[model samples]
Target: MQTAQTVMMVRPAAFRANPETMKSNHFQKSWDGDLDVASLARKAFDDYAASLRAEGVEVRIIDDISSQETPDSLFPNNWIVMLADGSIFTFPMEAHNRRRERRMDIIADLSHDYEVLRRVDLSRYEDKNLYLEGTGSLILDHDNRIAYACRSSRSSEVVGREFERLSGYRIHWFDARDRLHHPIYHTNVMMSIGTRFAIVCLESLSSESERRELISQLERTGKNLIDVTFAQMEAFSCNVLELRN
Candidate 1:
């Protein structure tokens, strides 16, 4: 899919470390019950939005309602996704609070610029404990119609197949583990795919066959693979995202 020149962000109102999500999310730290998390989160949110605007990118910031208390609202890309053909997808979130992050008003606002042909509601799968947290669960190689994913607590083959059937993307999945041998929570946290470049933590893929498949696919797709070690992936090197200017 073509990258959007415009991006959407949520201004957090009750942002804090989520207890339920912290188990799978390695980047999240448990708050020691002392810091002014809300205020700090707001400042960071504002600064990040300002930086994006400085780069000549249009950012649509939607204020998160306090009633929702969605701690991960800032990561809107997890609940909602927009396809190149104007298909809007609402995914099921692993955490209950994260599910509240999905807002129909945002879709209404986005429709002003993008043609929303239809909505694919995969939230029903959550009832079965089959979670697929939007772009967080699957990284799309849109041009090649491939959905790259690493199965974990928040993502699964059941929902991955659903995504493939609905979005018309082929699923390419492998098991990825952290240095501690724990499953990586989200696929986006371990790999990123771009038009001409791919950054991945090959060490995370324990199976050599899976690692080779990932490399072979990247090479076949004409992407320059930038391999990173487990330590580098911990530094957020594999968590790269591309934006259109």
Candidate 2:
């Protein structure tokens, strides 16, 4: 169960660069050219879904609430994670507005198709200011039962430990920084783990030891490591997802 055959996506209703997330997510920028950003986003989403469906992938598309003002709701993966074992985990988001992206109705919709044995809600940690934004903060190697996460505002060690305890997956924690020396907001932005391969930006690791350890672990687990440069990482070369068709 390293990869999923079915995936969920949210159609943007108010698709614009979120100011609340921009502070931590350096990759995001405000829309300068106004050609109807929401319209363009919708078209892109439709094309992406169509392409995935053409590839024999099951894509569940959900529409965002227009009045919610949750611009980043398009990324549903950050708030909720569904495991192959019928376990659902809800994460605590760092961005205030992003927190609203989590909807019980979506979970209910999913329950109609999938058997949800248990749900672990980690949003209570948000009261303590500890956040771990689902797959955004952690890159999971489900087949190997290993989780990789980089230290960042959105990814906290305390919450990571809790995730490890709840999910029964060992986590390898590391520090990663962008080219500008700022902590990489999300681990997914710097690395991705597939069934037999890993795409990572080794240059993003702040510590040499951490970089070596990550490489060693990936190699030990029989993963073909494809290293990318900082520039390529910034271009989202590492932010990739592998799905089973």
Candidate 3:
């Protein structure tokens, strides 16, 4: 689906800066010692969901269970993705605690609104320490059947190939890094695909060849590439998602 009228958001119970994910996630800010980070996160989540609901968007708010200890539970996009064909694919997460964020009950609840044709489980890759963080790992151009991914420890060629084999999406893989030359954790944080436009941090791509190839592919797929700088990427400008009302 190029645009979705409905979205599911998890209201975090124990939301805080996750130490396990901090090494890879440069975008996450460390919680200050004086502030109640969990409380702040909960308030932000509630307000965000409320704002979406007020905008006439159908927001499915699921409360995260405190006992789960999943600090990044609010980011449901990392664990599960639903395709237009009604296939719900579950992915393997690099962080063990993040893996616990996946809830079968939530998938069951989605059946009330969506026609789930099949459930594809790719979590088996976790046993081999190979992971693909769902939509976060892949910036998919649904109209073109192209899956653009920035190769990272959390997202590798092995699982990317498997995703292509299962979803029939051709993988356009590239190596992207931050200004510090550290690998970008998730593709979604620096690339986004919409029907008419693509937000991408071409500067983050390490190679000129890869940048040229990505631009060529995006143009061929009829997307106007809105190239962003590394600084803008760090500010989360490329992390935009499209929603249709």
Candidate 4:
């Protein structure tokens, strides 16, 4: 399936901006005041899960371990991805602390409902300084068997190729930059691929050739392209996921 009928979410016990991720993830911002960020985050998470459940979407909530000190545990997609083929792939994270977010118990929990055929652990590449932060680095076009990725420290070409070989998906690798000309930390930050539609910031691509190729492929695969400006992309217009109800 291109989209999932069920989704999993992590409820944070100590939600705060991660200092390690702040180096490359420009979208993250540190709080200025003594706000109870964790409380606010919990409230938002509950509201989001409630809304999804109201829409008939099966939402699985996992409480984050308070003693783990994993500030970014809320984003489970960055560490592990469950594929339609009953395979789970664990990716290497750019931030050292984020690696701690991976837990076998979560996989075991998911296996109760879903048939997990196999587990692929690519985290070993971290020892070589190569990283691929799961769905963050890849915007997968499952219908077309394509994996779109932007080259960044968090998304290495070596790992992308490895994923391509393992997952049997064609990798369309490209370079994408923010308005400040720095490489976009994640592919999902500037583009998203739905079943029959795609939201993309074409201007973020480094070269016009890459943009043309991307557009051509999307069109070929019957995607209705929705191009967003740099401002809209920075506002997270492209950071969206379409799930089956």
Each model's Cα RMSD: 1.4, 0.8, 1.2, 0.9
- Write one digit per residue (lDDT tens) for candidate 2, span 1-245: 78889889999999898888888888888868858999999999999999999999999999999888899898898999998788999999988988989999999988888899999999999999999999999899998899999988899999999999999999999999998998999999999998899999999887889999999999999999999999899889999999989
TM-score of each: 0.95, 0.98, 0.96, 0.98
Model 3 TM: 0.96
Which has the better lDDT: candidate 1, or candidate 3?
3
Candidate with better TM-score, 1 vs 3: 3
lDDT (Cα) of model 4:
0.92
lDDT of 3 by residue, 1-245 (tens): 58888998998999887999998988788756898888988898889888888888889889999999999998899999999988899999999999899898999998777899989999999999999998899988888889999989899799989889999889999999999999999999889999899999998987999999999999998898899998899889999888877
Model 1: per-residue Cα lDDT over 1-245, one tens digit each: 53667888889998888987988887778778778989998998899989989998888899999998888898888889888978999998889988888898888888877788988989998899989988888888889988889999899799888888888999889999999899999998889998889999999999999999999988999989999999898998887677887
Per-residue alpha-carbon lDDT of model 4 for 1-245, expressed as tens digits?
68998989999988899999888988889998988999999999999999999998999999999899999999899999988898899999988888989998998888887898989999999999999999999998887789999999999899988898899888899999998898899999999999889999999997999999999999999999999999999899999899888
Candidate numbers sorted by TM-score from highest down: 2, 4, 3, 1
Off by over 4 Å in 3: none
Cand. 1 TM to true fold? 0.95
What's the distance in Å from true for residue 213, model 1?
Answer: 0.6
lDDT of each: 0.88, 0.92, 0.90, 0.92
